[model samples]
Target: MRVAFALSLLAALLSGCASHSNPSPDGAWINQTAIDAAAEGGNLRQALLAHGPNLEWNIDTKGGKAIASNGFELSEGKIVSAADGKLRIDFYGNSFEDLTLKGDALVQTATDSGPEQRFKAPKEAAPAGAQPGTSFERGLYSAYLGGKWSIVQGEGQGGVVEFQPDGSVSGLPGNDRYALCLAGDCAAMSGEYDSMWLEKNEQGNPWIFVRSGNQLEIFQAVNNAKADEMPDLRPGASQWVLQKN
Candidate 1:
C-alpha cells in the first residue's frame, strides 16, 4: 500500500508540472532597435530595458549622485551629457555603455564589463538632476570617519581596535591590536605584531582604500595564497559600514 501511495503522489506532481509547462513569448530578448538607440540618442536605460532584461534603470542627471532601484544596484555615477534630444550615462567603479535615443526605441551595446550585451533599448523616462559625492557629502563622510572606531568585523581572528584622527592606529583588519601612541597633537602607528593586517601586505597584499566619499573598499585581498586558501581569502568586494565612534 505504501508503495502504491508513493507512486500516486509522484504522478500527481508530474501532472501539475505538465499543466504549467506551456511556452510563452520571451520579450526579454535583445533586438536591433535597442542597439540603434544606444548609437543615436544615448538611451542606455531604455536600450537595456527593452533589449535586455526586465530591469528598470535608476537614472541620475547630476554630478556625484547615487540612485537606487530594484533588480540592479548603482553607485559613483555622474551625468555624462543631457540636452534637447541627447542623453548619456556612466557609472564609476562599475562598467556601462554609452547610449543614444531616437524616437520610441534605443540601440544599446556593452561599453564596459566585457564583450557586452547588445540588444534593443527600451523607452525610459529621463532622469532628473541629482548627483552623488558632493561637498556636503564629503563633509558628512569625514564626520563619520572622525573619532574612534573598532574593527567590529573582518576576516581572521582580528579583534576590535580604536582610531584617533591624531594619526595613531590600532587593531588589524584581521589580526593583532595595532597601536600608535600619541603625545600632544601628534599620533602614528607602530605596526601590527604576528599579523599582516596593517602592513602593505608584501606577501599577500591585503589592501584597503576609499572607493568614493561614502563608499569604502573592504576585501580579503591576498596576493598569494594556496589554491585551498584562495577560496577562503580572495579579494571579494564589500562596502564598509560606518559606526558612530
Candidate 2:
C-alpha cells in the first residue's frame, strides 16, 4: 500500500509540472515599456516615435495565427511551438521571432544576444478605431514627414531639409511651412506653404511628393532603393529621393 501511495504522489507531481509547462498565451499583448523608452531616446526610437505611441502582438494559438503591428505596418504570421518550448512566429516573408512566457508577460529578443523585451496584456481595451494595424497610412505619412531629411536625387541633391514638428521646414527650396495631404482636396490649404502627399509604388512601398509652389518634387525613401542605384522615380522625368537623417 505504501508503494502504491508513493507512485500516486509521483504522478500527481508530474501532472502539476505538465500543467504549468505550457500556459496558454491566447490574447493581445502590447509593449508599453518600449513606448516609454522611445520617449527617453531608446533604441529604434526614431521609428517608434514616427509610428503611433504603441506596439502590439496578438496571438491566437488555437488558430495557429499571430499578428504584430508597429503602428506603421501590420504583419501576419503563423505561430508554432518549437521542440524546446519556445513560441515561434513566422511572419509572411522571411522574418520571424521567438517568444517565451514569463510570469505575466511574453519576452522576445531582437537578436541572439540582444536584450529581452517584455510584452504585457493591456489593462484596458484600445480606443475605438485606434487599435494596432489600423493606422498604417497615417503612420507611414508621419514617418516620412517628421524629422530631418536629405535630398538624394532631386534638384536639391545633397542638401538637407528639416521638417520641424510645428509644420515648418528649414531647407526646402521655395516653401517655409508644409502641410501633409492626409485626405481630400490638398490644394485647398488656407496657409502659405507647400503640400506633401504619398503614393505607393508597384511593390506596394510608399513614395512621397511635395508641391512647392508650382513645381512638384517627388521623393522615395533612400533606404528602399536598390544598392548603388536609384529607383525609377516616374510621373515626371526627374528622380527625387529623401534619406532620413
Candidate 3:
C-alpha cells in the first residue's frame, strides 16, 4: 500500500512537470516582439519581470506610460498562476489578460482570436557592470541626481530621495537634510541621516548603507546601467536597486 501511494505521488509530480514547456515567468523579461497582424504598426516595445508574486512593468521602472489605449499602463499586478505555459494577470478594477509562453516570448492573444503580442527575453538580466571601485563623477551625474528617486516595489517600500552636488540628500516628507559621502563605488549618508554606510552585497550591485543608531537599512540600485542609457539611479529597499534618469 505504501509503495502504491508513493507511485501515485510520483505520477502527480510528473504530470505537473509535463504541463508547461516554457520556462516560468518568475524573472525579468526583456526584448519584445509583437507579431500581431492586426497590430497596425503598433510595436510592443516593453519587458516585464515577475518578482515572485509581484509584476514589475518596464514602463513604471523607466518612468512613462503607454502611448496607445492597448499600451500597457504603469501599474502593479499579481500573478494568479503560471502553469501549462499560460499566465493570468490581475490588476486593479478587474483588468486582466491571459498570456501564453511560446519559446522565449510571452504571447497575449486578442479576444477575437486576432494576432498575438509577444515579449522576448533579453540577452542578459542587465548590461554588464563596470569594475568595482568605479567612482561617481559629479559632472556626469549632477543632472540625473537633481530630481526625485522613488521606490518601485509595488507599495510602501521606499521614498523619493534627491541628490545635490554639495553631497546633501533630502526628499522624504519631514525628513531632515543629510550629508552624502562617497568612497570609491559605495555611497553613504551621515549627519542627521536616518541610516549610515555598512557594506555592499556580494553581487556588487550599486548600494548604500543605512544604519541609524542601531537599526540598519540597506538600499540597492536597480536597473543599473552606464550613463549613456541612463544614470544607474533607482534604489529600492535592501536590494539597493537604482536607475537614474
Top-TM-score structure, candidate number: 2
What's the candidate order when arranged by decreasing lDDT? 2, 3, 1
User: Which of candidates 1 and 2 reaches a greater lDDT?
Assistant: 2
The regions of model 2 sitting more than 4 angstroms off are 1-23, 38-54, 82-85, 112-115, 127-245
Ranked candidates (TM-score, high to low): 2, 3, 1
| TM agreement with the true structure for every prediction | 0.23, 0.40, 0.29
Query: Model 2 over residues 138-198: C-alpha lDDT tens digits?
Result: 3332344556678876667888877654445666555565544332233222112223532
Give the Å error, residue 222, model 1: 34
TM-score of 3: 0.29
Q: How many residue pairs clash in each candidate?
A: 35, 0, 16
Which regions of candidate 1 fall more than 4 Å away from where they truly are? Answer: 1-54, 62-72, 93-96, 112-245
Better-scoring candidate (TM-score), 1 or 2: 2
**Which lDDT tens digits does candidate 3 get at residues 56-166?**
122221222211112222344555655676766666445665667786666665555334455554433432352111111122124223455554432334766565543
Best by lDDT: 2
User: Among all windows of ten consecutive residues in candidate 3, which has the lowest summed lDDT?
Assistant: 43-52
List the global CA lDDT of all models. 0.34, 0.54, 0.38
Candidate 1: 10-residue stretch with minimal lDDT:
181-190
